[model samples]
Target chain A: MSFFSKIFHPSSYAPSAPSLPYSYDQQGQTYSTTSYPGNYSHQQQQQSYYGQGTSGGGGGYSYGHSGFPPGTSPDVIRSFEMVDRDRSGFIDENELQQALSSGYQRFHIKTVRLLMFLFKNPHDSRRLGPKEFAALWSCLGQWRGIYERYDRDRSGKIDLLELRDALYGIGLATPSSVLQVLISKYDDGSGRKIELNFDSFVECGVILKGLTEKFKEKDKGYTGTASFDYDEFMSMVIPFLVSYD
Target chain B: MSFFSKIFHPSSYAPSAPSLPYSYDQQGQTYSTTSYPGNYSHQQQQQSYYGQGTSGGGGGYSYGHSGFPPGTSPDVIRSFEMVDRDRSGFIDENELQQALSSGYQRFHIKTVRLLMFLFKNPHDSRRLGPKEFAALWSCLGQWRGIYERYDRDRSGKIDLLELRDALYGIGLATPSSVLQVLISKYDDGSGRKIELNFDSFVECGVILKGLTEKFKEKDKGYTGTASFDYDEFMSMVIPFLVSYD
Candidate 1:
């Protein structure tokens, strides 16, 4: 089975069974299973977490104990290095922007800034070195894990239905029509399939996660509910829509 | 003294003396001090923390003892209600986005996402009620505190020199040239003065904090030092430069 397919197989979803074995080299650019040291057991632990949603207390998903659950992959690290144009051991904002825009597709500058903010060290708020880059790489992996978990048919893509599940799984309550709008925005009108690949999956995740979190913030009192007028809703969702431009 | 001046006076930097008081209403649209209990004391605690960097172990700045340090403001709450477009007693994603973008200057979708993610409750990830919105508002207050603390002249603006201090205060080791480039980006080439206002200050803080944290992640050995190749350094610094566009 393909790596993505293998991870989504019904057998892998069994609460008791460990999921697939996945690991990356220190650079996080390459993937390997041999000589990976305790990764299988780690994957097992992670799979159990994913299978049961035991880490559901946070209202969002938690991939591993902390710090790069699947560990960093060589592919992720190499992506960062490619962006490090000057061969500096660190990745700064411009380099990061270039890397992200070119590699992951163009993200809003604010989104890129936020991602950098989210990924960078709290103490060293200037640049990202190898370890920091690894953390970022690992984050993508976590998102991948989320994507794979929801790609139940092992299709390596997420349809509208799967997208709904993915959002709900991560704690979003998007309306059907709103979701349709979102899907249509990304749909290239290629095939009848209204599905998202890994990149689109990540993008969708980013937008949904952001919107949901923002909504929850307003819903203080722990009531799980808040109100918004039309303008407020537009302000929140329009930026994420493709047509916002 | 002016609000900005009062907060940034050199004496305000004293470790023991409490700093000035600042608070936002529910919408965070208006700034007010009425009906805000204990916020002054809370500001005192927060200022002391900022002045001495007592919470310095993590290599990043820490705002409160827990979540919502200065607590929420009435204006922040009002802001949420204003955004409840449908009057359905709930502000959905679109409403939330509209409120945020129009109210807070157009933030990157990703940044908005991160804010939502950070502010939303763990258990209820769908909508944000008043309390959650308060938490989000308070976070902006915290960012404002950071901004005010660094606005040494109480100018309500962060000059390039002040920006340097802001970065350093947050535990970044920025080179002078890198700092210069960053200043030039926001200079506007008007007067010889190069500075950032509140919004820009907040943006700079987010980027700096993210990068610093990322750097610290790599300095795992805690030798208090990490190295970067030329390309790596470029990647790290270029993002903060003024002329990147």
Candidate 2:
């Protein structure tokens, strides 16, 4: 098979598949888990937010938002209200991150911003209102289903092959060159190969979704190609890259 | 802004932020585009396959499979036949790989196997029959919608941040460590920070999805954690790690 095909498919390629997961800390030493102190952390803040409600109990939180979309599920509406700690009927990236971390999964602020960007709330671009929150929540629900279905063996992490299949199942025939770059970005081990826990998988999907969506906008002709001036590209993408404290 | 947050969040970390994209080929030399020989490769075989069809006119393939699932799109069914090089009633990883490469984006063999595994064919596990092919095709359609939506900048690639957001939008709050490792895996640059072109993005998502699903099998409680005897873990993960010849 490799002969007939490999012989035929000569082309432009970048296949830098990482063999073992390389562990590197910023200071050039091994990253220690103890460095994260409990005194002050997004974790503590997130925990505090959850503590105010039924901590670890799937639902039943301090929700009072009556402005939710008419057909929004009580679970989703309450999820939004739970995150609106100030009772202001709005949730920013941090709040969204906290809420998800507590109720569903832990998300990075970067991911939350992408959510806000995609499920933009007409009420506020910086945050989500009841309507926008419901929309975003439902979207998450769909993805969750997809995630559950693909986790075939129930190992809590998908291996390299499974990941490839999942992408194809979704119509994105990802090239190997790109796959190497994509997985390498999420190195989480000292010397182990990278694998996707649910959280990591979600991150991977979101990144792809965002890139594909952004590309489609410019590639209006479905031409599989597009062009962007540098600054224009940065403004469009930077919001997803920076970590706002 | 970094004070209350950064102070409280002093902790364990692996912050090997690549200052620039370092381009390294497998041979410890720069991976040059010219290294790929055109005399024999999968590209030529794929080209020959396309030449047999209405090249670039999508949905025009030499399909003879009549066993497709009910309600299958004609486009998808036609696509299956296009890749069945020998006109067999089924397709395997290489065939799927070739079909996807020609019709949509080029996918790695590793990924095609994942699709077959996820959407296993009742007729054969090694290959996909009409039923499995149809199911896999439908899933791709759903992902296509998502990809277009997140490609916000209309640029061909998603910066690190966009990838982060897209994952969160889907309900997976990816951690920093994982994100870092993931992107580093796909380093396609000589000295450029990693970015997600559509193929790369899909590759990222597939890897994560596969990993997450595998992990879930052992994490029946949705515990976000799982344990495996060393041998079990290796068997489960090796398919993803190895590139089948």
Candidate 3:
């Protein structure tokens, strides 16, 4: 079966799909197919606002007022410039990927591409200038803050003990065995102490955060217990597996 | 077929499954069945640590040194007490659910149940004391901070415009139509201005975050595009659907 057909299979939608109340066109633009209850003045207002395009700033690229402008941290800006290897005052996909993976761990290529897509100016798709880079930098700053909070010993890197603490701090009740696997997987293999530098640390955090959210969704009863038949478990894990591959 | 059988069908494990390296017994406990490459001193250390139980904090509930104690925020503490309704100094499942669903909108029961499980002491699952409540509250605080940062008008709530920016800020390029559907779904119908209070705000954030992560996992080629067959789409959405139900 084709990918789209598999995703939009009739039976899967038959029992409970009405809850979505929206449909997608061939180009993947979503539209509301069902009439929402009530007068819904706000929705109308939004419709008109979106209709205005530039005035409403309603398109995919225009984030409207809530989108904070990028930060002005010198260290962060310097890092961005340094990564812009060509000195063209802009960082492209390759440069950004290199910055994230060099001297650390190799990031999944897709992750690098997504970051580039998100931070690149909507007007200029080829590269990221300082402002756009600053926004990306700020997001990293948030992750860095999380990393620092978990790095209790003030060490530049996170040891196995600290990693365990960091996972729990984020509210994931990760099994000891799973934690064991992660430490072994990310360790630099230097045989010093199983530790992760900032880049590796952030990657681990992202994966754990994503997986934990998915697990919570399945274990909705909050029983601290979840059972997944083999197929269900495979579905839950396929993304992680595919990414690693 | 039963859920477990569906998930664990032997055929599913025949080829690609070996890469997972972990297997579950009847109780759902995960153990590594494959020997990892290398001597893996760190894994040995962790095994010994976990083996010590009380000393190593290996049990499922122990959380070990990784579990940081709750913060001492007076305002946050007050909110927990307010939710405790019975003045018993503890929030039971019902009270906690009521608090989350009370003024703004009724959250999914499963979501509330999951929250309860995550915060409740593993040994005493019936209710949450101030410390446990505080931890949950602090996590909410992080979400609130993100909300406020995006809520430029300081209106104490998020409108459609703000919601779009918030999603983008978190790296999701949700189409405008999807944003419209979300706002309409959450608006209380009071009609002043379609907006979301703190509780509703946090709920929206959680759903968007989960979906975005899933989407990214699939769009690994970094083309900023993804296609899902019917089953794939259903898997992406089942969590949101089940929660609403």
Candidate 4:
């Protein structure tokens, strides 16, 4: 029989095909798909309320905002150029290195490692170009809490204070005593309250190695490649947080 | 004024603070906030006609029928030892490679690149264990199309006629005149049809450089480390496809 006929008429093809490709060798125990943490209902609710483009009457949903400019090849190139300000023909390791090192104090070793794992698989010599870089940036932008907190002065620099707010916003608490010590030690000493700049702020936070370690350990082995796979991440984190604290 | 007070009453803070961040680079680019792809009208029609989720109200629409089981632990390590009949502890790369090399014809290079891009990105690497692997397997089940075309008897094997039919499916016109030439060249003197089992069929497809190039070009260079930044990729591809085609 013809292929079209087989597809349309299952009887023509004989017994029903398997719904999914996976099968066990002999354990007879079906692989469980429901293992992610957090209530499925809650996760679905959160995604529906906040996910920017889950589904829509169109391929995209604007939610009553201005639509995306008609994307064109030139526009894509232009956007890439804006991100790769140096126009180095390719976004080499140096550029990514710079971005990573820019404010090292805020970055944990584990976080950086996690980021690297996504880049090129442990020094395979493939540096992320404009496309890979853009994807990561777009993901960071969608991290609502992080983005919201980082936009200090609503200007969005997240230079220092904003970063502080972000860490706290995500449930990482900084001890007040530690903050006091940092301010007093690093302040310009003009006898006025000190505004913590990047360096000083990172010092305060990074010094809490125990805290960083705890958070990192908590995030072990979650190397999913899709940002939208929040269910995966959230599931790991929530149960661990409840258990950890 | 206190920082909180200044924030609450923006007039109380230094006027320069709020304006400064926005104006640092460009003032008017107040984020697109909403943008997406494809024709809205078609999507709306599909939504109503097919009962497909198409709007902010439906969270699962982006994935179509590809839905993960509800309530999976993002960090839970569902032991695979029970699943692997040999107790390999892990499903090694060799298994995947062998599977591809054996039954499958040369996979589209673009599909490989896309898969690599998905697997390589760090943000998305959140422990792609068995369940996650199943999801990916389901999505790529489209490969069954190739198998179906070649396996003529529905007995999961291919004879000469089936192979020829498979080749012809790709627009490799097999004229009646060429059929005689091929039969004479390939068939046994006994008049039996020459057959290519899965392995030989795979080898033939892989050797086709033209098909490889087509797919590789299709799957290269996307940013979003966690997901294919459909928006960014489409922005460049759409314009090029429209103008060039």
Candidate 2 or 1, higher DockQ:
1
Q: Give the least accurate 10-residue stretch of model 2 chain A, judged by summed lDDT.
A: A16-25
Tell me the tens digit of each residue's lDDT in model 4 across A8-33.
22212111101100111112232221
- Model 4 segments beyond 4 Å from truth? A1-78, A85-89, A93-121, A124-126, A139-164, A177-193, A196-245, B1-245
List per-prediction Cα lDDT, in the order shown.
0.44, 0.45, 0.45, 0.29
Go through the candidates in order and give each one's DockQ: 0.02, 0.01, 0.01, 0.04
lDDT agreement of model 3 with the native: 0.45
Q: What would the per-residue lDDT of candidate 1 be over residues B88-194, giving only the tens digit for each residue?
A: 65555556656545333453443444344434554444455555655454445456556677788887678888877665554444555545534544543245576
Give the TM-score between model 3's chain B and the true chain B: 0.50
Considering the two chains of model 1, state its CAPRI-style docking category.
incorrect
Query: What are the per-residue Cα lDDT tens digits for candidate 3 across A27-51?
Result: 2332221211122111211121112
**Lowest lDDT 10-residue stretch of candidate 1 chain A:** A32-41
Backbone collision tally, model 2: 90
Can you tell me which runs of candidate 1 are displaced by over 4 Å? A1-196, A200-245, B1-73, B90-93, B102-105, B148-164, B167-245
Interface RMSD measured for model 2? 19.4
Candidate fnat values, all: 0.00, 0.00, 0.00, 0.10
User: Candidate 3: where is the Cα deviation over 4 Å?
Assistant: A1-245, B1-91, B98-138, B187-192, B226-233
Per-candidate clashes come to: 96, 90, 15, 29
Worst 10 residues of 3 chain A by lDDT: A15-24
